[model samples]
Target: MSETPHEYPGQLIEQVRTAAAARTPLRITGGNTKAFCDEPTRGEALSTTGWAGIVSHEPSELVVTVRAGTPLAELETVLAGQGQCLPFEPPHFASGGTVGGMVAAGLAGPARASVGTVRDYVLGARFINGRGELLTFGGQVMKNVAGYDVSRALAGSRGQLGVITEVSLKVLPFAPAEATLVFELGQHDALEQLHRWGGQPLPINASCWVKDDTQASAPNLLFLRLRGAVAAVEAAGERMLREAGGTRMDNAQAGPDWALCRDQRLPFFNAPSADLCLWRLSVPQTAPVLNLPWAQLIEWHGAQRWLWAPASAAREIRAAASAVNGHATLFRAGADGAPDLARFDAPSPAIATITQRLRAEFDPSQIFGQPA
Candidate 1:
């Protein structure tokens, strides 16, 4: 199929219907930047770009409805202009990752630990189910019905079950002002501090720690962010600073710092000459957490760890994570590895059964991954 939808209809319903009729698989691509996602897609690829835009925006209601193909960056720009934000701070997977991809990938940024995840903010969705039929659920208004929230299910499905064409998201007004409280402490103490804050209602956006492994002398710099009014932020920082016995650092790169943490592009991302494999580690927020000697970047308040486990020793990484009830995925592997990468961790039997059923329902003909 040519890039120009010359013969094919750019409509979401028509596209899926055509794929179903042809028995061709469909691969979904919004912004194609995050190619290092879950399993490499098979069959034909579908682009949601042509079908993108914000259909509804009620600033007062704090809700916005948009087509699935919209770029998150574009949405963020619009929301920022309105003094609002996505709250979850979905990562920019790549230059091409779209709103659809954001939900499907089910990845959230630093603030995720505090506010909520992507699925939490999704109000509803419209999609072309596996049977090539367009289905809609949820309402334009926030906090509506609970009848089979397909919108939440659609998230992280990777277009395996349906083609999401429209979405309703709950948004929040941007905080009146923003500030990050930065302090460098020992890794042990930093981790302890994170645990302590987890128990309190103290306002914080993201808590992250970075270590310089080789020297073993690197300060485990911890960062805390607050957004709202200037006075509140200042007061919170001052209180927290005194409580932790740490002072505030410069705020020059506060925003960028958060962004880098979300995209996994910090110094930790460039592990050992930028040659080590990058793994998105998901460990439970409990005792005896992962203790690595090398440099590690903590985001989502230790819920998510961007690790650099080189030599493609996935077995060691997986084994360690499994021992502690943790899960790991090789986000970016070394060049020596295979191109057909596996981004999913082991799934439970029940989940497997459910996933298979969902696949059958949204993609009876299995046309979703079929790139057009």
Candidate 2:
């Protein structure tokens, strides 16, 4: 596979056309911020970075359209100017993160449990398929459902089915008020309290729990974010404090703290050394503290958990997650890439069939790398 000399959107089609004709695989690359997300791929590198810029924006209508290669930060800055935001809070992991990578990764931030995920905000998309044909799905508005909503399906496809060219996303108004509160409690108590508050009318936007691995006797810290009307946030803060002793975090400190967690800049996410592997588990919020032999950090009110352990512990780690009806992934593998381990859990037989059929329909030539 060789790099195509063409640079324009139409030229991109020609590149794919040539590849399809030759039956050669082409690996799509954008800001290159998410290379660690999936198994290493092979093929000629097709760069989307060259096709970058916002296409359209309607602040009053709360919608923005942009080229897939547009930088995520640039789009966010544009939305912020209009008092709007992409509430999903996708992580960049590195500079040069693009809108295409954001949608392809389909990762939502702390607000996800309360607001929505990336797929929920995706309105429409245009992509060049394996046959070198361009196709558009869905539309700018929120309610356009004449045919199958393939736009949302492409949200997390990771460029497998096609090369995303443009996208339309629903923007949300920035919250008028916000506050963070910290509570000290054990993991079990924190989980119970999270469930209790989850069932109430309190404006709980996000919750995170961190325990000290070095000192088991130390109490865990539960951080909660409340947002909405100023009065509502104040009232919710008062109620939460009454439930358990808590200290209010300065509004100035809350923003950076949340950003750190979103980007995994906190020490909690570091492996301490390159030898350790990082595992991510998605389970029921009410599930008990996992009985595993690794340090853990709870987020999304216990719906998402992270741990750093040796690659050799993969089996025991996955078993613990499965016991709770959850699934685990080797988020960041060790030096060897966890050769014998599955990065993602296997889907059911029926689901595998449906997925393969869809892949065949969109990419008959298999010009993109196989699924992770």
Highest lDDT scorer: 2
Report every candidate's CA lDDT: 0.74, 0.86
TM-scores for all predictions: 0.90, 0.95
Please identify model 2 stretches exceeding 4 Å from their true place: 1-7, 214-218
What is the per-residue lDDT of model 2 for residues 1-372, given as tens digits with 9 covering 90 to 100?
112234588988999999999998899999888878676777899988878888889999999988888889989998998899998889878899999989888888888889889899888999998998989998999778643268998887888889999899999998899999999988889999999999889888888898767665867899999989999999999988987999999979889989988888877887766888888899998899898877788888889999999888888988899999998988888877776777888877997898788789888899887533
The C-alpha RMSD in Å for every predicted model, in order, reads 3.5, 3.2
State the RMSD for candidate 1.
3.5
Summed over model 2, clashes come to 0
**Ten residues in sequence with the least summed lDDT for candidate 1:** 1-10
Q: On a 0 to 1 TM-score scale, where does candidate 1 land against the true structure? A: 0.90
lDDT measured at residue 79 in model 2 versus the true structure, 0 to 100? 91
| Candidate 2, run of 10 with poorest lDDT | 1-10
Q: Using alpha carbons, what is the TM-score of model 2?
A: 0.95
- Candidate 1 local lDDT, 296-345, one digit each (tens): 67777777777676745677777777888888888876765545445667
Best by the TM-score measure: 2
